[model samples]
Target: MTVIVREFQPADAAAAVRVRRAAAPYTVTTPASMVNEHRAAPPARRYLMLVAERDGEVVGYANAGLAYESSEPGQAFATPLVDPAHRGHGVGGALLGTAEEYLAGLGAREVYTWVLDAPECRAFAGARGYRPTRTLRYQRLDLASAALPEPPDVLPPGVELRTAADFAADPRPVYAADVEVTADEPTDIPFGPVDYEEWLADTWNDPLLDRELTAVVLVDGAVAAFSAAHTDGEGRYVSAMTGTLRAHRGRGLATLAKAESLRRARAAGCVEAYTSNDSENGPMLAINRRFGYEPCATEVRHVRTLG
Candidate 1:
């Protein structure tokens, strides 16, 4: 069987999303979200999405782009995922090879990817010169049945909880809090300051972002912590990001924000809630556990250096 790998098109959005969900069931994705991500990519990142078709049927896909937000240049990423039924048919290889060539042409010195923790997946990456760098855990919660914590009846002085929708008029404060919190996140590629315009285009306006479900904690009318929520409008929700500013750390502001977001998500008819965290991030992991999230799967970050 011949496998054809080509650039993704808007028409392929649904198929691509299906392949991704089949490959990583714990992750949340939608056709609209896929289209939005492709259309909103910044020019500098040179983002590209590739699809693998077998006899006119989409079987695999890859998302490749430079880490444009990193302080270090020449850092790129390519994540190739193949439907389980199509594995071992060269579909994944074709998609990944095409992605790597394209990224290298765009001057990527190092390419990173996430490989499932399964032995076959790890061996496939290892055989291709990729070395494991870090691990990430994907967690899931049964929002329909979990015993979620109740919010306090009396709010603390100067502390308030609000949804991201409240800031539709002005989101700069949310952006500021995001920047500060993201900077403290541990990652192999160090991130530089995020440009507000880029954040607005890529994140704030993303079609999948659920502003009503997103919860924000404000202290004295200033944003201190927030939980960004993404929903696929099909009973699937994911916590895109949840963090607290350094000054608000240890005050349980992030926990409060996330709990509120999850509660809102449940009330809005979301069934399953998913989130991911770096293996080294203990605080967030503990918080997720408190919310009855259980580890569903793991992926290891792998890196390959290019000449």
Candidate 2:
């Protein structure tokens, strides 16, 4: 079967989302988010999402870019996803080849990608010069059956629970909180301080992110801890990111924000909630378990070095 890989078009949003869902089921993705990401991609990153077609239908897709935001040099990525039914054909390999060629041309000397923790996936990456590095596990929570925690009626002396909606007028504060939390999360490589403009254009304006569903904890009138949320119109919600500043580490603020956000999600009719955690993050893993989240899938991070 002949497979063709080409730059993604705006009209391919729906098919691209389907391919992603088939390949990485736990991650949050929607047609609108796909379009937003592809359109708002920063020029510095040299970002591209390529789609592979077989028999005139989209069979796979790839996300490729230079990690321009990383403090370290030579970092980049090209993640490919192929529909299960279309696998074993040349689709995946073709898409991956195009992705790597694009990244390498952009001066990338090192590239990273996530492969599902399975024999075939490992062997596939290993055959292509990728080496296994770390593991990440996806967790699932049934919002429909969960006895979610209630929002606290009373607050800790200086803490207040709020929503992202409250900061709509000026989201720089939320952006400040996000960079703090993101800098602390485990990463495949070290990232530089985030670009506020990029965050505003891509993340802040992401269509899937639900401002009211996102729960925030404010301390002394400043954004402290928060849970970011994204939802597909079809009753599926994702715990996009949750974080607390290093100064507020042990205050249980992350837990409080996530709990409140999950409660809000269920109330808003989301039935399936999902999140991923690095295997080494015991603290966050335990916190998620406490919320009755169960392990669903495991993925391994793979890296390849180019000449």
Best by TM-score: 1
* Per-structure clash totals for the candidates: 0, 0
Off by over 4 Å in 1: none
| Cα lDDT tens digits for candidate 1, 108-174 | 9999999999999999999889999999999999999999999889878999999999999999999
- Candidate maximizing lDDT: 1
Candidate 2 Cα outliers beyond 4 Å, as residue runs: none
Model 2 clashes, total count: 0
Question: Please, what are the lDDT tens digits per residue for candidate 2 over residues 1-307?
Answer: 7899999998999999999999888887889999999999988988999999998999899999988888888899988899999989988889889999888888899999999998988898999999999999999998999987777788899999999999999999999989988888888899877788999888899999999999999999989899999999889999989989888889999999999999999989999999999998888899999999999999999999986
- TM-score versus the correct structure, for each prediction: 0.99, 0.98
Error of 2 at 220 (Å): 1.3
